[model samples]
Target: MERIELVKSIEANAERILEDFTEILQYLRSEGSDRCDEVQNLLFATRRMVDLIDSALEIYHYLIRLKYLTADTQRSETAESRDRDKMLEEMFRELNSNLGV
Candidate 1:
């Protein structure tokens, strides 16, 4: 599949996961402390899932920015293009940090 298609798919899946997590959280709240241990475990798993989804979304946004920046750079003059190139390098560094790479 194409990159944009993949990003859209990931975003859709992330939205579904967040919706499910909200439903589960509401149910757990209604249940009170009767299943404290199970609730805690589920919360931890939900947190991890959220973190992963957030990372995926961040990367998706980074790709979008990179695409726009590249297009802008291509249309710009030499000095402006150099500045955009620096910006692109900074964006890559930021992305790498976000991915812990």
Candidate 2:
């Protein structure tokens, strides 16, 4: 898939993970001490999900920065190209005038 679509998918998944994590926390809070082992398992799973979400978010930010930097570089190159073209045109005009053309 495209870079933009990939970035959006990562963001959407991260948000869903956060929502699921919230629900897990709420369930844990309402549970009794009888399900200690289950609670522990859930906690571990939630921790892993948190780590994964953090990584996804980091990647999303990096992609966004890369996109902007690429755009800026393209703009700078275009400006340089325009300047070079103008300079060449001026030089040709001077040469033609000298030759009485």
| Candidate closest to the true structure, highest TM-score | 2
Please give the CA lDDT of all the candidate structures. 0.70, 0.74
Cα lDDT of model 2 by residue, 9-99, tens digit: 6677677767767766665566556678667757766776676677677667757776886788899999999999999999999999999
Every model's TM-score:
0.40, 0.61
For model 1, the superposed segments whose C-alpha errors exceed 4 Å read 1-35, 77-101
State the lDDT of candidate 1 residue by residue for 29-55, as single tens digits: 564455786677677667756766775
* Highest lDDT scorer: 2
RMSD of each: 17.3, 4.3
What residue pairs are clashing in model 2? none
lDDT of model number 2: 0.74
